[model samples]
Target: MVILFNKPFGVLSQFTPEAGHKALDEFGFPAGVYAAGRLDHDSEGALLLTDNGPLIKKLLDPKFGHPRTYLAQVEGQITEEAIKKLSSGVEIKGYRTKPCIAEMATEPENLWPRTPPVRFRANIPTSWVRLTLTEGKNRQVRHMTAAVGFPTLRLIRTKIGNIPLEGLQPGQWRFVQEKVI
Candidate 1:
């Protein structure tokens, strides 16, 4: 089964039990289904889960370079120079990232309220940006934004390849056709 899940903030990507965090198993996906790619507990957005081994491999293989798009709300007003720096790429954990797309974006219109909410600083303004990357790295978006002088206040994934976070609310999942994707 191919499942598109809208993972909520503070939820673990996997089904394993953890203290003070919700896991995928709690949502009752079919047994043997596993996350093709993971989103950290602090991030929210589109996550793919499937039981097919070959399908998972195809999605995750770096050579395939499946693009994932994220909408990040960053601290301070995002500058053109920062967008250029992001597009050119940034080094994380000592490894340089591949060149990808980044642009200033308006706050997403239908965003759900985060539980507990992102931190607010009255004196510090925030801006939204759309970032697309083909490689999945540990906290890559957070690291990239901070490297460019705008620390991310909130992160959300909006799309993965052809599938998007459409129609699903936080913690909701729906089965999809694997072949169509």
Candidate 2:
């Protein structure tokens, strides 16, 4: 079985709770299902879970070049130049990211309010960028945006491959057809 979970902020990707952080166990995922990949504790959005080990390998393997798309709210009014730079790729933690899609995006129409909310600054403005990456790296989206001068204030994975979050609210999970993988 395949599952799609809309992970909430402050939740760990693992089933085990750690250091006071809530984990997947709190969400009541079924036995035998495990996360195909991880979303960071502070990041929120679509996380794929499955019972099929081969499917997990296929989805997590970088060689497949499966796309994962994120919506990032970053500091400042992001410039076209920065968007272009992000699209072309940037070096983060000594590794140059693979070229990916990056473009200015309006806030998602169905966005739910974040718990505790993102910090607001009276003077500095912020903008949203839609970034699609074929490679998953540790904190890659946050690092990439910061490398180009705009630090990410909020990040949410909106899609993985062709499967979208599709209006799933935070902490919600649903069984998805395996073919969507």
Candidate 3:
């Protein structure tokens, strides 16, 4: 069985234990299921878990080019030129990301309030943006925004392929059946 979960901030993606922190058992999933991909311990959003290895590989492999969309809250004012640069592609670290969709959020919807909250600056403003990427790299979204001069304050994944975190709250999970045909 496949499952879609809205992982809350501060939670580890695996069921294993690490030091003094809580694990997936605290969230109550049956044994044998595992997260297909990981969200950083600080990031909050949609997480896919399943027992099927082939399905998991298909979802996580960059070769598939499955688009994953994230809602990012960035520091400072965003310029039109910056948006264009992000859309065209930004040199992140030594590698260049493929062209991805980046746009200002027209309305605030489907976003969950982050736990512990993000740091706020009295003078600098934060803008929310929707970023869709076909590749998943280590801290790619955060690095991309930083490379362009606007650092990301908060990053949340909203969708993976056609499945989304719809109706799931922070720390919530639901079983999703995928059609084999």
Please name the candidate that would achieve the greatest TM-score relative to the true structure: 2
Which model, 1 or 3, shows the larger TM-score?
Answer: 1
lDDT of each: 0.91, 0.93, 0.84
Ranking of models by TM-score? 2, 1, 3
Cα lDDT for residue 82, model 2? Answer: 98
Q: What would the TM-score be for candidate 1 when compared with the true structure? A: 0.96
Q: Compose the digit string of candidate 3's lDDT tens values, residues 1-181.
A: 8888888888888887677655676788767898999898788888888899998888877888888899888998777878888898999989999999998874257566777889988998988778999999999999988988889888889888878777889889988764421
lDDT of 2: 0.93
- State every prediction's TM-score relative to the real structure: 0.96, 0.97, 0.92
Instruction: Sort the candidates on lDDT, descending order.
Output: 2, 1, 3
User: Per-residue alpha-carbon lDDT of model 1 for 1-181, expressed as tens digits?
Assistant: 8899999999999898598898898897888899998999999999999888988998888898889999999999999999999999998789999998999999977889999798999999999999999998899999999999999989999999978888899999999864524
RMSD value for candidate 1 = 1.3
> On a 0 to 100 scale, what is the lDDT of residue 120 in model 1?
94
Question: What's the distance in Å from true for residue 82, model 2?
Answer: 0.2
Candidate 2, position 17, lDDT: 96
Candidate 1 overall Cα lDDT vs. reference? 0.91
